[model samples]
Target: MFAGSNRLTIDDKGRLAIPARLRAQLADEYGKELAVTLGPECIEIYPAPVFRTMAQQIPKIADRAKRVLVQRLFLGNAVESEIDGQGRIGVPPLLRDMKALGTDVVLVGAYDHFELWSYAQWQANNTEGQTHYADAFAALAVP
Candidate 1:
């Protein structure tokens, strides 16, 4: 499971190095390939197998609605990438633009997946979301 946060920089070529610990986990499960996709407010990185499972779950619907939703979310922007020998993956142009990724980014481990966020955007998101965190945990408490 991926867990913890790391601050990383995108190189001039727009490549970010996966943290060594995370890289080990990915290597064990996926060899070196990963799937990058647009997430709610950031970019999601998935080990190939996990990505495949997710892809398979996209419901099959009528041609009209299915094409719009599935194509936009699954086919429209997903990029398949391979981790380089040095353990870095290049963020594609479209994904970077979608997330407004700059030089500094926050890599957040999200259990089975990871998310990449621009440093500034992450700060804003965390600040806004922190207040509700206590409520979320409290709701889960055993009555």
Candidate 2:
């Protein structure tokens, strides 16, 4: 039930700390292991078990082309990491390059995972979402 946004900085070592409030829940549910990967527009952090479930779902895809696409988008770039005692997870250079992560990043809660977006990208993304909110909400049947 992660539901908030957190603004954080990437340390010199490229580590981003998970917000304290969410640390305990993550520790309890997934221990120190996490699976990180590139999303369409951001880096996504997932509990190892949660990521395993997601990986399992990929293979069930019936469309060969779509399945391959999912595999390449997810499996190909996925990296397994461990959260340290201070609650920090290291973002690999490749992942950083792929997502264009700058020093400042925004961690947006996304139910099953947290999305990491550069500050500028997050701002732009929010602006886009704001413009489409009415139509998006209507599509979701929100009244």
TM-score of 1: 0.89
* TM-score, one value per model: 0.89, 0.93
**Model 1, span 1-143: residue lDDT tens:** 88999999999898999988889888886778899888767899888889888877675555768657776876567888899989899888888987899889999999898999999999999999999999988888587
Cand. 2 Cα-lDDT: 0.89
Give the per-residue lDDT of model 2 (tens digit) for 2-89: 6799999999899999988888878876777999898877999998999999999998999999999989989889999898988999
Report the number of the highest-TM-score candidate. Answer: 2
How far is each candidate from the true structure, as Cα RMSD in Å? 2.2, 1.5
Task: Mark the regions of model 1 whose C-alpha exceeds 4 Å error after superposition.
Answer: 60-67, 141-143
Residue 28 in model 2: lDDT: 75
> How far is 79's C-alpha from truth in model 1 (Å)?
1.0
RMSD of 1: 2.2
